[model samples]
Target: MRATEVAMALGEPDIHKRVEVVRTRLKRLIDKGWLAEHQRGQFSIVEGLNGAALNGAAADH
Candidate 1:
């Protein structure tokens, strides 16, 4: 999501600050190779991870 969208979703009144934080965190993740930046302001998960495994801890009893 875009920084604006992230700020809105977070209900942060200071959009600029929130956007900066989002950008910083995204950059860190990207640098660590945890997320792939699709473009200047877009990102996607890298391949090879199992979605079911990732969600397994939240499974309903």
Candidate 2:
């Protein structure tokens, strides 16, 4: 999801604050090699992180 989408998902009302939070999360994910930013404000999931366990748990929801 884009930053805006992520912000909305997190229930952020202010756009600027939303962007800030999304950017910070994205940067951290990138640093951990779990996510990559492709185009401007776009992101893609990268392999290597143990995200499967989280995904599996969420799948039951």
Candidate 3:
């Protein structure tokens, strides 16, 4: 997901979201291995931190 999507998931209103702030936080999470950037301006939960990982479905990724 992108920062804008993350903001929406967090319940931030469409007209009030601060994507820059969310992007900064996401970068920090990447630094800590909590998230992985899958593409430019996009991200995914790191394996082992989400259900797919727990179910062994993410091992091939």
Candidate 4:
């Protein structure tokens, strides 16, 4: 999911904190090779990972 989408889904009391959580999660995913960034802030799912986006299904939160 996109960053904006994830932020919206998080719905935390503090918007900044929510965004931070999302960013941290994305970074971890990148380190794990589950996601590949297309640009500075854009990302897509890594190939051959069974549809696991770096952001994970929890972004639907």
Clashes of each: 0, 0, 0, 0
Candidate 4: where is the Cα deviation over 4 Å? 10-14, 51-61
Clashes of 4: 0
Q: Tell me the spans in candidate 1 whose CA falls farther than 4 Å from its real position.
A: 51-61
- List model 2 lDDT by residue over 1-61, tens digit each: 6877777777887578768888798878766567778888887777445455453332212
Residue 51 miss distance in model 3 (angstroms)? 9.1
**Residue clash pairs of candidate 3:** none
Better of 1 and 4 by TM-score: 4
**Residue 14 in model 4: shift from native, Å?**
7.6
TM-score attained by model 1: 0.60
Candidate lDDT values, in order: 0.63, 0.69, 0.75, 0.67
TM-score of each: 0.60, 0.63, 0.69, 0.62
List candidate 3 stretches off by more than 4 Å: 15-17, 50-61
Better structure of 2 and 3 per TM-score: 3
- The true-versus-predicted C-alpha distance at residue 46 of model 3, in Å, is 0.7
Worst lDDT window (10 residues) for model 1?
52-61
Per-residue C-alpha lDDT of model 1 across residues 1-61, encoded as one tens digit per residue: 7666766677766557778887787777666556667888886655553433333321211
For candidate 1, give the lDDT: 0.63
